[model samples]
Target: MFTSRAKIAQRLLRRLHGTNATPLAKRPARPSVTMGRALALGLGGAAGLLGSAMAVASLESDDAVFTNWSATHSCHPAKVYHPESLKELIDIVATHHAQQKKLRVMGSGVSPNGLGFSDDSILTMSAFDRILHVDAAKSQVTVESGVVVGDLLSHLRTHGLTLQNVASIREQSIAGVTQAGCHGTGAAIPPMEEQIVSMEILTPSQGLLTLDDPSDHRFQLAKCGLGGLGVVTKLTLQCVPMHKLLETTTLYTLSELKKVHASLLVENQHLRYMWLPYTDKIVVVTCKPYTDGSPIGSRISDDIEFRLEELRALYKQVATVPDPDHVNWRFTQLRDSLYALDPLNARYIARVNETEVSFWEKSQGSRVALSDDVIGFDCGGQQLVSEVAFPSANGSDLTFMEDLLARIERDQIPAHTPIEQRWTASSRAAMSPASSPLQEQVFSWVGIIYYLHEASPSLDAIKDAFVDYSKLFEDVMAPYGAAEHWAKLEFAPRSALERHVLKDRLRSRFPLEAYRTLRNEWDPHHILSNDFVDELCSTDL
Candidate 1:
């Protein structure tokens, strides 16, 4: 029952790698623009000085200058190559391998930690975005690495199929999500990397190899291998039958959350908690699959029209203060700060958080929507986020949450609202934070956020406060068997000892030496090695 969009897109992603491989003539390739004429997207930093340090403009000598979605990371590579065909990609890899050059493969550049940044030869997966095959009987679909998650979901909708789980955002590349081990909130669902039925990786030394069998050690390691062993060109993913979802957003007190936390996971198919800091408020979101229904309630609040006015008021207040040039009236975080009398004061921020609790109380309701539409939520503007995963206990990780909140309040930190906690079943990917040989174990992910609203005079000070807040949580969570999410692991500045300690901690949890040995076999010359992966391979520990 595959329609043209589903049949074609699914086939478009896989057919390019078949026995008689040929480029699809239906969809035209995305043409690259020359330097100085290409898009100059530069975001300096969540920190004031860091933002100004990035040179957003492209140089005449360079093919293109790149910055990540959050602007936390940027790079000016010597050359940027776009290979439209698999044969062309193989040739490029072979040449880079022969020269023993540092060639890094990139996706949508959405990683906040700047995983895609490279100073040497940079290759984009932009042109490889096609759905190559679909086997409805097996509930599987094949796609090229560059295919955006949003587009893939739209295609699958037509075929009455959808992914088992997806991250909160849809703008990222499929390969990036899988490699970074992104996840959705579900006690039974594993991280997104578990969707990979097989991946066709273009390795420097091995030419092309498919990691298909789950029992194979290579498949487990390379599934979330941090893109070291090879460049993943295409993958076959397991999909489920399409279904609608009923979502409800409800307000709760911190005590109430502790009481009902275990029951929430047992009752709902997907659940996430937003802990409003400095206030005794928590917002619990639950989504359950539904057979058929009309839209029931409004997820949108009645005061939506006044959101901009609240932002303008903050901008006006920020502009009149000392360091007048810092607040950008145009760049806003309406949900982040509705009313901040004093943006950095503990007592004043608590009032703002209380106002936010009121806002959620008003906005709380139930609604029915398609799974794809409901799963995607607005992540808001550029922000600095750090998330850690720990084994789930008694249905939730409230013990860790209560400890962290106590520390934040005791220190009077100017933390933001809605510090979140989400759950996922463990993954088979060897390096994943929730790594396990079995998928039955559940893990809880807790996150702290500091919104990077543009032009705030208090930006640097707020960032400093976050450092203390996060450090305390890290120290407390160590005994609970915690590990930072792969994508957000190295975002903070670390000293040599800190770096060595982090490396050692990672080695203790993951199969670092074994992975390193396998990587040496697949990419002996280290042509595909990037900074992140190189750090893991280092023996300095």
Candidate 2:
């Protein structure tokens, strides 16, 4: 009984070649007026000098900047510089850090958090994109930080190798993805960071230190160091032989889903389900190893997009669609298989509009792509987002999600988008948003996302609501020591940011103060302090 939405989405995904494939449509031309205005708005005269310097150094690779993604964080890097070699990257970091300029790294730019931005310099690992070496005997592959996941997977596929776990989107960089401990659905496997056998950290001073020896204790934690310890120049990853996955999708009510939670998780290799907030209908997907010659053909499907489009159409017709409760029931009753075939069938395929679009309509009942105008639906100029991660350790009682839905409705927040809750097993990374200092058990994570739709709200109002509501939900789960996802739009305040995180419990984890010691050890002249890191982390100006 997998509903049409989930099933069609899966089929559409197969045709899209795993999310990056372009839809069969023409590139809509930019409005001349919009283009002229944007060019006019560009910083000209003396300020334009910096912009020009960036353009000259940008990467020539099409795979260089994956713009299909959204900015999780607030800061927009003025320009993205793609370095082709370690020496060049080192020079870029050195020069920017020397000028006390803010520099942020770009890797597929998939996070919804503002952690990856600087108004001045954006560093791209595109040039560093290569499989430097592979030890078949050890089952490890060393790679530069800039390599794309799909590209990495395709290359590995040729040699019978794959990363341990990948997030829903395979467009993230190996460095950036693991930097925040990105993960997939699986009880036994930890987040992506666990797959790192070793890494080469390029500190402003320490040049490059090959971090290995998983038993070092600190090594495990530092694997997802959020580019804080230093820039990740090279990584030695543990890989498995490429294998096919058996996946099944089904629908259930929230009440019904609770009954089978244990059986679904304990009995399956990978399990994940999504329930539209305030709705009883749940879409459950389970994936496991499949070797039964399951029609070795492309398992593509476009039917999901058709179903999602149907859902969108339904939402449009309802006029008053904000009530999550109503949305849930109405969406469930709608036909699901109107677009898809039997879930067990092979040769699945379909297309979709994977591009992120805004809710705003241009003409009556018509919508336009956000990128068409460049400013992105005006998005009210800019917005901030905060995502908190809670553990499912207590059980998938639906209580956490249920409570969240109620609160948002009670407060009447302008939550225009569907709330997302993805699950990942606990991580062993020291600085990951999903780690607990005092506990050593695997925790099921529930990620809560709230987009600050408009900056018009009073700063105090926004901050208070974000902190208070989060604390309420977080406090209830704090006893379990739930961790947060690193790359989202919201982060814990300063005091709490230090307290709840292992970076404080395990000060030796990042050695921020000791990094000062290492800063002196490596670059005594203070020649390479990145302003983005300095300002964001509150290192002395």
Candidate 3:
């Protein structure tokens, strides 16, 4: 589903002006506070009077920063709760369920959308960080949902085990990453959720339940439940033996990418590429299982260091412009100048090569290290990002990618950031972007990013530019059945879902009917629902 660029621009302006522009009819009304507060007071007072062992801090302040890492979306919950134990978490959920108060579960608040935003209450799972068990023999780890990816990796490494894959950013909690279907680049590897052997979910009705059977249909629904069905407390993930990896970075032209695209996916254990907009050059990175005999050396480069300084200076000059309109114009000029640089320039190409080369070199190159250090890379500072996944069932043609690049060039979309292209095997999770129950082997993910550096003119200007380019991207890729990444930024509205083609695509691509049924059966009162989830799960489409 898509919206017109003009409407998207108008919406961005309204948001920038600090106004609630969402239509009243479309916005879900916040739950009644009188009933919620009364129930909360009753349950809480009873527990305090009884001197119950369960302990949790309840906050009423509405100024909490429940925003994502990018700081693009923020929400103010009527109450925020941090439960340190399973009993405490259950008590909180039961109280809210009785009070008819909606709840949204959050973990490090990594989602770029409003998926975790709620007016009734917000439950932070960070307190649940505990490694329950480590089965070194089976190569599996059982941990609480709050365990951060980095921490889990370190613990697992001590026991000679590691996760199968991780997102680009390893700060996200394990539950958060799995729920959002976070994935790495590899044709043979699936998203993080696929590694789950079992999980303990606390549903509003079922209370605390464990799904240990892989054959159970509910496992597929709950694995990527979008925090709808329940709160994930603990998960048992099937990990692999810890091993080191060797990574290499190389630059290639557009023509070269087309020729080697097929081989690249199969040749390396992990492969990803970044295409520079308005240029024919791209950077390809390959990570494979490291063994003896590989070369070990590191070369320092200052190309990126120099470019960062120049960018900082340019941003400073643009920010000094007095008029807002002039600031916008200057920002446009900055983007154009950044994108128009010739790839032939020794310094420019050197900078691109160094950036990629140094990333691996600093992390794992020149020496074998854990996969977490090798596969994961910094996503950069705060930025606005929109990533979409399209099925490359055939894995041969690059028409969709070629058309996207062509459209950006023809329209001169002011896209200065590199377009990242990655591949992943099909996922069994119904809501996964790369979901293909029919046994499709490969899928492609294309990410569009607009970095909101400190020197940027304004958040509004960056958002406007991003929306403009995204609308064009959506229009061109819609024919190929593209699906937005759940954790990334997307502007699709409910009205757009009414399109027959998009509606059919979504229905077929995702098990929406089954998910709807499971959600209704488990969360009949909609306590775990939010505006984003509601719109996305709407049956009207």
Candidate 4:
């Protein structure tokens, strides 16, 4: 287990190396200058390269290293500045301000968006990752920016506390999660950032500023601020006591799935489901709070590696052989197990298996086959993705889903993958791609994936077709107000984003004008400006 500080430093190194043209050590450093004195010499943007080697040895703790989820990104920091304390963070920000380089705060490198990296400087709050204060009476905990969600949860468990909700993966940095406005399903709930009661912001002009009482309009707006406002050094999150989850999983026919949806929701504390498009069936997952003398269940011991290998075999068989549908059946049996069992029992199951049957067991992670090593395999490298969320304002309904599946089968689109469908309640965060005003709106998330028989095939010809299909689907879901996920491929043109979200409304909540004022007020030199944020805000999409 790596210390939080060490982990953060490693991630910085990875980020730096990932983008740099030359490998880190071989790259020449700027002319001689001290770390702090280097700033005085007017070397801001290029200083990160020099800072990388220095950061590796300066980690504050081992707990810090365990905080990072990906080893690939651990050694990429242009400069890893780990302040021994929060006070140091203020000085670092102020120093960068003087040097004319915008400073970016890194949480965990979970986002594909290049927001966390910059040519200037990067600051990691690994040293400050601790539970500063926990108020059990008020059900709140003040956490440093560098803390990982899983670590926090472990500590909270000891204190009989837990976050009201968490994302599928708990490896995210506390500061990073809030900065990106990560969220989960449910209408009664808000995004993770919404739980923040206050934040300690380390800004250029105002050092160690605290935004108290996030319920206030200013605080709420800044809670989801895309790190353009300032580096969040710490956060105060509202939490609830730990509780056992009683869950249930059931397969429903298309009509039954639609009919029982309401009862399932009203009867459970948490609900999510998956659908195999064109199959007329949906996997229903429902979880409720269990307060009885329920025993904690044991962790699963599934042969995940073997299963992944089998999946690769299935994909290969489907691609080269004629038993494509058989492969699909096998995969569904494995994937559906995530929601296949009754919540009240201690039962577990593999909800989905590449094989055609669903059985009891624990939640199984998504895995696809690797055809690279298979003998006689000729397809070039294939990319697999899971892109699902509420349909856009233009998506179709059950009929559309069924029709698409039938069409794929009829036309033999060459892309043979089962479309997984899941339903989610509305989201309150304005920036959420799936934002909706009606809390009870049920939106379906459909994923379309393709595996090829050749390497690096051109997707241009299929792009137009995908757009047409997405538009039709979006039109069907318009009344329900659906949206897409950020990281996945999108069919909605940049123009639709403008008209759909009412960019003016986003500007209002994000406080674009005020943020600009704050940016100018805090970072007068435009040190932190990046083409990514600029393009995102400026683009019609």
Candidate 5:
């Protein structure tokens, strides 16, 4: 039924967009048979046998080295299983545990890390995607773990309901995003995992476990389990009535932002700022609920597209230039050209201004659209990213961020991508960077991205430069009690984690002991363990 409905939706979307391009929904093929027997059969008699058969039928011998969306990490798994039902998932886990084989769960593989990789077997939740129930009165929906955020938002739009917040990219699976501690910009909104009211998990030791009560200690542990606890089968999420949002973007100097940062946070429902590398210019985006019947604005305007194309062309030209001196000259010219385009660039003389101003002008605008449409920004091509979260010294000070920026400039790091800053409320999830036992009202998340343009001949050089720059980044952030985002480019080993300056701070902030206890009890045999999980959990701190 979902397949046919999805096909019809694809056709309609194609007609609406006036394009013959194949829809994203049509990219992945589904299997013929679903998992398990009806609930009437229960868990015994023919039901158990049927479930096992289904699991076996769904299993495929996959020996390919799976690469993540960013093409950053790859791992070869022995086999892959696509279980469509709770019973089948339980059976698969049991079989894998009995065979003493390790297992990992993957959903769309949007994370840049190697979290979903396993040498033994991988269980993909894509087949289990479905919306089981919706309670309009409570403004809640129950969906399988594999449901993508974009699809979920679209489904909820028809019912006049939507998630309270979503990350910049909507392609990640709900379970994937939740477990990885994905968050968006807003002082009131916590990570996506906070929206999950309850979830059903299939564990090797425990056949099927339902965590419904938010008061339960285990619920907090399981919310951001890093895929170390078990496989999440389904989740019940709290939602709000659908609404439109007004988005405004403008260019601000770093000095100017420092003064109004507090007011900006208070005035907007969602706020985020981007700092261009090698420059002091920042692009500030503020979004708030819009109630007036203003016409919806286009997500991307022609002017914005034109600027982006020009930037791309400039980068392409730099890649082809053979002379190092000429390349450096082009870089300066490109920077100057970008600064010239900014309306605010005229305030500072070209020679006196050392702040980067490119791309800020293109993104500046005011648009009123559905909250989801306005919030979801493009992920921008294959890239590597590192996002770190640190506690706000005060609710409104930008001293720490200012110091960090100065250090980057002093060190002369070759960072070209924008540094994004956003705020989030404290979370209850044990492993979340934003988690706080004190229930802190605000925390700052800073993200640094590096685009790995595949077509560029200087890709190798860029990667090398990023590696050296990242070491300095880690060193500078270490003293601020910063924690790396679970799904980003954090390759620190167990030894390094123990030695980290903020190790004790993180241990205290996150309920590390309690989480370890619960994880051990649920996954005694470590069937879902991977190198990353093991290293992370092995930290003595």
Candidate 6:
């Protein structure tokens, strides 16, 4: 049986995908499917040997490589500075400024869009992780840039305070989260970036810029500056009292959700939908603060054994192909199981989608928990995931989503399980995806995901399919004034014309002119940018 080997494989998968913002060497091209980079994933060796190689790969070196969480982007910087203090951070920037060298500030490496990639100087403030102060009177917590969300929440719980909203992942740094304009689900609540009361930035020409002055033009721009304006050293966030929350997961079809989405938005403090493709169901997850602390609803989460049995039955019939150790066979065993045989076939994919719908039907209810715990949930491991934000002012986003799913089925795109949908109120941050002149407007953030387990039998081909699927969404969302989420925005290999097209796309959606003006004025040397950033805001464009 592949059970024992699969368990060991998962253990090695987690270790091999290390993060100090660590970098792993990309596996060389395979002549065929044999091993399928299993050695690089630590699957070839026994567990002992696997542990040794992981240590070696994880150890920081003189020429240490920096790879993002997705392993799609990496950089070997000339210097990786972990500045311990604000003074130290300023000094590094000042030196780089004097040398006319570029610097890209990296937080916890949570961004998958190459937002922090630089071949020059890479700055990580991992050493500057400290919760400076918790103001009891104001309900605010001051933290250094490197302080991650998980740590901050634990500290906040002790102080009887929590963030106004939560992000999907706790491992993300406060700086990274805000810069990306990360958010939770709520039409009434703005993104995490909107929570920042003030921030201290280290710019090249300006030196140390403390953007507390709301009237200042740079203040709003700096809040969600896409990590390009400068190195975010410190932030003060407005917090709320820590409390228990009641969460409920209710299932609905797309038509049902459309009929009741307005009511759902009105009733719930936190709301998000998990729309399973090739099926008629959408998993509705709603959370609200429960003052009484009484738990409601039985937990209707996944019955793993039941799910496994269904998949096993299907696999026994359809999975004639061998090679049980394929890495993609775990969380998405059904998808990979089918893909291992016939990839992207509409008829075959429908069978897998039916299995997913069955799993959701068997388990979809909720329980009570802390506000933080309920807000942030699991976003599956390693994949090509991208979220596009578009105006939902008049249910336009709803129309867009319906059209997207229709397109997927019509085009017979071998789509994944959940096309997770979330909503956020407007943000003042100039570059925030949800930023708008009208404060009352709401935007929908829809994530299109395709898991890319490296040791999968058909990783390359499936990745190509994902690219096509994602591009289709981008094309469809364009008319809806859609903008890619800053953190998950993607830029693949492109021509000069395509690059210009991308810049034009952003120009239509974001306040690019103001952001670029501030960027140029503050960092005249362009020390705080990478190629991906430069591509978008370049004056030459």
Candidate number achieving the greatest lDDT relative to the actual structure: 1
lDDT (CA) per prediction: 0.72, 0.49, 0.66, 0.48, 0.67, 0.72
Q: What residue runs in model 5 are displaced by over 4 Å at the alpha carbon?
A: 1-54, 57-63, 294-358, 393-397, 458-461, 492-508, 539-541
Query: Scored by Cα lDDT, where does model 6 land?
Result: 0.72
- lDDT per residue (tens digit) for residues 1-541 in model 2: 0011122222323422112332222212200010110111110010111111232354222222222233223333455465545777778777765765655665545565544544555665544556777677777788877666656766776566777677765545678789877777566666788788888877665677788985665466458665555678888899877666655556566778878887887676666655444344555656666665454333323344433454455444533433344334322222221112111111110110111121111111211111111111111212244445555665733676666657655654323223444455566665665564534444565544333322223434544554555555554445544555666524346475544453432333334564444445545544333343443344422
Lowest lDDT block of 10, candidate 2: 40-49
Per-prediction TM-score to the true structure, in the order listed = 0.86, 0.64, 0.79, 0.63, 0.81, 0.85
Question: Candidate 1 — which residues are off by over 4 angstroms?
Answer: 1-29, 37-63, 293-332, 336-343
> What value does the lDDT take at residue 123 in candidate 1?
71
The count of backbone overlaps in candidate 1 is 16
| lDDT (Cα, tens digit) per residue for candidate 6, span 36-123 | 1222221111111111122111112243455666666677666556554466667778888899898788766667676766777777
Worst 10 residues of 6 by lDDT: 29-38
Instruction: Sort all candidates by lDDT, best to worst.
Output: 1, 6, 5, 3, 2, 4
Residue-level lDDT tens digits of model 4 in 1-541: 1234333334344434213223334212111111321211101112222223442322222212211222111223344564545556666777778887755665554543334544445565545566778888998999877677766877777678888766554656777677766655443445577677888776677666778752454465456666766778778999987776655456667777666655665576555555443345555555666656654354333555443454444344434443435343433332322112211111111112223222322233221111111101111122233344553222244555665556544543332234544445544444544445666555556655433212223344334444444544444444443443433323234476544454443453343565566666756765555444444455353
- Return the lDDT, model 6, position 189: 93
Candidate 6 deviant stretches above 4 angstroms? 1-62, 293-295, 301-303, 320-343
What TM-score does candidate 3 get on C-alpha atoms?
0.79
Spell out the clash pairs found in candidate 6.
none
Kindly indicate the candidate among 5 and 6 with the higher lDDT: 6
Q: How many residue pairs clash in all the candidates, one count each? A: 16, 29, 0, 60, 2, 0
Give the candidates in order of TM-score, highest first.
1, 6, 5, 3, 2, 4
- Give per-residue CA lDDT, model 5, range 434-508, as digits (tens): 888767657889887666655444556656666666667677777677788888745552256434644565565
Backbone-clash count (model 5) = 2
